[model samples]
Target chain A: MAADKDNGDQEMSGLLKSNFGRRDFLRTSAAAGAVALAAPARIGFAQGGPTINMQTWSAAVDTVQSHVNAFTEATGIPVNYGNAPWAQYRESMVTKFVGGAPLDMMWVSDAWLPEWAEAGWISPVDEFDFLMAYNAEAEDFCTNSMTYNGRQYGLTYYTDFMAFLYDESKIKEAGFDAPPATWEEVVEQSLVMKEKGISDYPMMLAMAQESWLIEFMSALVFSHGGRFVDDDGMAVMQEKDKGAVEALQWVVDAVNTHGIVSPACVETGELSGLKAFASGNHAFAMVAKYRLRMLNDPEQSQIAGNVKQAMMPKGPNGDHNTVGWMRFHGMASQAAQDKARAESTAKLIEWFGGKANGAYTFQKFLFLDIGAGFGVKPLFDDPEIRAAYDAYGNVDMIQAQQALAMKKDVVTPWFGEWNETNGSAWQSAILGNTDAATAVMKSAEFWDELKQDY
Target chain B: MRRLFGYEERSAAIFLAPVLAVLMGVAVFPILYSFYLSFFRIKLTRPNRTPFVGLDNYLDLFTNDLFWVSVARTVTFSVVSVAAILAISLLVSLLLNQNFRGRRVLSTILLVPWAIPYVANALMWKWIYDSGYGALNGILYQLDFIDKYMVWLGDQDKTIFLIANAFVWKEVPLATILLLVSLKAIPSDLYQAARVDGAGVWQRFIHVTLPAMKPGFMLVLIYETMMAIRHFDLFFILTEGGPGNASHVLSWHIYVETFRNLSFGSGAAMSYVLALVTFALSYTFIRSLGRKV
Candidate 1:
């Protein structure tokens, strides 16, 4: 009886699945239209006058709100500004885009440019000569990052690059007059620091598979003269001479052989790594250069006076290269369709990303409020911005490294798909589950497959 | 109105229309549409290019190595989590079943873990598992269990289990409540009869209590199995399917495919596969442990 009942149940489930027809599907699709009402209630629509709906990740909230208030007073164009937590921001924006929410403008990452552009979710800004004028004064890579295909998509919000940082006190205590200049020197110094009992893990890396993983990996790859994808968008990370293997192998040896890098590095994310580095526990780290502001602030860091930036170490065939990334103010494609809305959003984008009242007001203030790097070349000579950087950072080294910084080669429409696989493959190599070559090869293969799909 | 159809039926149809419409709109439609979408290549980014692909999505998943690995990880996580929750809940419920001082207070205290939000619980555990100054390290260090602080969640071998520990902590309270109700519903005469038959504490528990907790066990098992199989938030918060894909379970795979890769078709197919497995397990538990239909 029990056997008969189980068989009957299985049959029922099978029958249910098999019985679904095209008519039922059509009926369901029609019924599902009601779910559109369940979507989060949108803000007021701009019927009387143009209102720019802006979405940003919650960072510098007070600063952004004050700026929005000022813009409204100055332009008389009301703005609906909403923000989500930084970690979940992209997911939320993707949902809004897919659901046809009333989005006028949003912050777009360089990594998302290709995908967003291809999807028609965002519109290009090539026609806006007012916005385009800033491109000449902007850093070349920053402008390039904002452009997808042959058209410019937006104006730069901010740009920053990875920097190699070390605790100067620990380095001095370990009897090093200068920081390492190359990958080999890093391993040597790390081993010496480990043997001296100065630190347990002399080199700290946030290799945990998260959003920041690609940035960290890219910096290493670029400095080592390797590209995950070449200028022509073909995978070359698997090539032995391309410097990917050399960089990855060095890390593997540091963890398993030299014991300089903690095995737990695989699980450590950038946030945790920052805290650990600030706790005066490590001699070397690779982090965002903007973090220098926090590191040198006595209130936030234990090693406040000791933290210092260094040139990114070179590989055998590479130079002191690093990865640069930027976020920009973008117009929604739907909004851009309305010429009046387009003009208003373009003006708003210019207000924040370029200048306000004929001066780099937003850029100047943003740099002062947060140590976020600006793309405008003129702001580099600003007294307020200069003083802030000189307080905590070396302007010369920042400029030199920024010059060397390259946009990530792997940013394509298929980037999001390829990233997880690449991160995992690199991690597997670090864990000794696969050889470095095999991992690199597998990543390249996956990249090729994704590239094919696109 | 009675002449239109029948006296009672006409009135009933009129009254139920609103509720039935709502049910069709919200619940039935989504499931059917998702099923429909699973048969097509619906890339959300290229919203215009969704074409019918028949069984291609399912075939692709079945052949993919990552999908297989995710399946193994999902099975491992669900089995471990459900077993741990069941064992802990049973023990707690049995102890609570006894007449003891502050029983009510203890029961209320047991619900605290369950009361915490999923995001908050994951964040709390994240801090606890920090290799630097986390509570786990602090306590372990204080006890001289280890000479130095050791990585907890970051460690690949321990990532899934550590996540499971957090999951079990929250889940045990609800399971305990269910089992406690079963213990309460038992007649006092059952215990008296067992005593009359010279059954000792252990024997009576074996023959009477354990056997009687079947319905509760079925409920707990089915519920937890489904929860564990589809659990995403903790993995998302903790490892993010990281440390060399050590904790990349099926649910995370589905999310990455749908949300990250924008491959709604394959993601929907994977979700259906997970649903089928969950349903099969629930059915087996009900058949073995539930009261006869």
Candidate 2:
């Protein structure tokens, strides 16, 4: 007993005298931190949750969780649900995929269809007849957006197009009875609004270098009757009279010459533009159609009751065309290798992307909650859905504009690489660092280079 | 007689094995792996098609116009940021070193900006520099300094400086502490001797104080230069190398090349180049540190 006590006392004295306690605590804390950091970066597989793992950008989190809970209760399959912020979602997902983190299903943007499919990060869902069957019900545009290399990847999460939104109060106050119908008219009305001391910068265009830049530019180019790439996937945007140059030139003149759009528009992002427009500081803005709901929400919008949508202004040689974009649920290629996990993932995807309880429950919930455009034709005719649309937007105008919305011509395996260059080129033109023609040409050259390399 | 442990050297090696293994795992492995990856064409999009492309990535970057532009921007940004950091920290440290009341509280409070993560700091600055509803514009407008809420970050001419400002603010605290340490280490007898030599405050500062700060200056110079050269979060959060690539520095270029373009080989090559430059800089500073003050 004395010997044991002596050993204990000696050990205590050594620890205290050498400051081993502090060192041990720091060492243990560091180990704990390393383990903690490694844990999340590993696959989303967890101890208590269901075997099926689903990841998404944080959007409508509560609604998604509720649906997940219902699915778990009904199918007796638990799910591990996780999400990152929308801005960082793509990088997070890419890192997860490259690190070989186990992902069963996750949200994918239409723009990434070719890249992800090429990387073998995601697998085609055509093998599942039940999921494929709903493609017939989906709009051809949405369905086409989801397909790459003749393989269908997944089902639609939501779909929307860029729309021309105006503050009704601002336009009316600026002595405009109708919104501008052409790019020239847009400049004229904006100048008038500016001259009259109404809106300082009467036009809001988000020319910031981000994911949304390509869409905004595409909409402009398409409406001006320009194609970024030809049917053979060759560069056409660099052509002098092609819509790209004209669209870009107009934006440059708007910022530097007309004084209608803020030079700061080059720094403005889509969300920032939306908030600016809602704050009633601009007479006109170009944003995704779904933003109309938020622009008209009394709690969030300063110009709630007076926000209205108009057809995208036609460029000099172009029609009122716009860019359409969509997001879909993707099945990880790894998850498809195991038949059991495949079935569980498919059921979960179906539950969210397709019919839930045989009633398109998830789609209805998503559309109603967020006002995201639905791909199903049946939902368009639903009275309640139509009424919700009528409250915030013109149903006729929405259909007419959406009909002209085109998928971005730049979608390819090398789209991500090309997009960075293209976005910078456009911003360079807007900032007068380069002329419109050079910007368009630079974008075209890079696009072609990437195409050849890929 | 047989002993439980091996030879002294062998026992030391055995004891060091775990730490060496960890260093190899975390640090040495990644560094070497990236260097190896720099030799291949590791496009993530074309994962199955990685062909060893022998120094081509480096050649392409060195030849590219955009790469040169990014290098120039990085140099300018680093120089301006480091200069600002060194000057401001020197001033702040001198003030904080004094035996004033609330000195401790003030010194502790000085770390608030340094304590915040660079990302959080970037976000705060983003709001402050916002074109609309920005506190910068609001305060300037209220002060009658400007007739309008002028573009700040969006102004291509001023973007690098604005980003540099935020970076310098976050970096100054650590540099100040380092300077304060140097000040504390200076012998009081030196200052007394200078006074006895009929030196005034300015002369004493130049003769006694400045020379003693050589080590601190060396530390601050090396650290801040490396940090400023690689600083990414502010540019990413604020401009994303825009208002037309005005703030497009080498670090952003590497990020765009790697993550956005998914060209890991080229990204690795750029990183290795940066690492080499950093090492050369540190070596130069260390050599200068050994010089007479």
Best by lDDT: 2
Q: Write the per-residue lDDT of candidate 1 for residues A316-389, one digit (tens) a residue.
A: 88999999999999999988999888888998999889888898887777788887888878887777777888
Return the lDDT, model 2, position B186: 98
lDDT of 2 by residue, A9-106 (tens): 99999877887787788998999999999776453334333378899999989999999999888887778899999878877888898899979999
TM-score of 1: 0.90
| Model 2 per-residue lDDT tens digits across residues B86-111 | 99999999999789999999999999
Report the number of the highest-DockQ candidate.
2
Interface RMSD of each: 1.6, 1.4
Q: Residue A264: error of model 2 in Å?
A: 0.5
- Pairs that collide in candidate 1 are none
Quote the TM-score that chain A achieves in each candidate: 0.88, 0.85
Model 1: residues with Cα > 4 Å off, grouped in runs: A1-51, A68-80, A338-340, B1-12, B291-293
Question: lDDT for each of the candidates?
Answer: 0.89, 0.89
TM-score of each: 0.90, 0.88
